[model samples]
Target: IAQRAMEPWAGLMRSFRAHRDHVWCKLSGMVTEAGWRHWKSQDLQPYVDAVLSIFGPSRCLFGSDWPVCLVAADYQSVKRALDDCLSGLTEEERSQILGASAIEAYRLPL
Candidate 1:
């Protein structure tokens, strides 16, 4: 399971290096560890950096787990937390994080 899971990360690194354009990447969701139910806090920044470092600010997106996030935080709180985490990024990047990335990825109408 570990090996299978890592393949996509490897592939993304390779692709990011190869393509100069932006790529939308999704991190693995909340994990199970030490009987504590929480998202991987430390891993978040580095992963965000990896994506931003490779694809720049325009390509990144934030996801609130919605009903899943509700397991620990309400939807509004989740949204606020995402906003706080992404506060350092540009407005354009923030826009991408909020919804633009999804529309672009799925080829939805703007």
Candidate 2:
């Protein structure tokens, strides 16, 4: 089974969906994972859409990788890129992805 039963991402999505009770996903670090020099937000849209579809807004959160991301993009660029990817969602969904989900995931006092 380990030889060819699963593609890495396919396996990951399956596992993620199966473990929804405790697992949540963070959409971040994309800039570092991409081309870095000339990558565009559009380049990340598909992956973002995939994560959102599988996890839904409630179980997905946004993260800014901060100083580590500076190697590939500035802080503002990273944020703007995620905002662009999230542009098509409803306001409530965007709010969930942007902030609400994090609060819930972390059980923050806010």
Report lDDT (CA) for all predictions.
0.56, 0.83
TM-score of 1: 0.58
Residue 6 shift from truth in candidate 1, angstroms: 13
- Model 1 pairs whose backbones collide: none
Task: Put down candidate 2 lDDT per residue, 1-110, tens digits, no spaces.
Answer: 11222357756896868866788889988888778787889888877887888888888899989889998899999999999999999999999989999998899996
TM-score for each prediction? 0.58, 0.87
lDDT leader:
2
Per-residue alpha-carbon lDDT of model 1 for 1-110, expressed as tens digits? 21224347746686766775545664323222111245434424454556666665556566666566555556665566456556688888888867787788778985
Give the Å shift of residue 41 in candidate 1: 7.6
RMSD of each: 5.0, 4.7
Per-structure clash totals for the candidates: 0, 0
TM-score of 2: 0.87
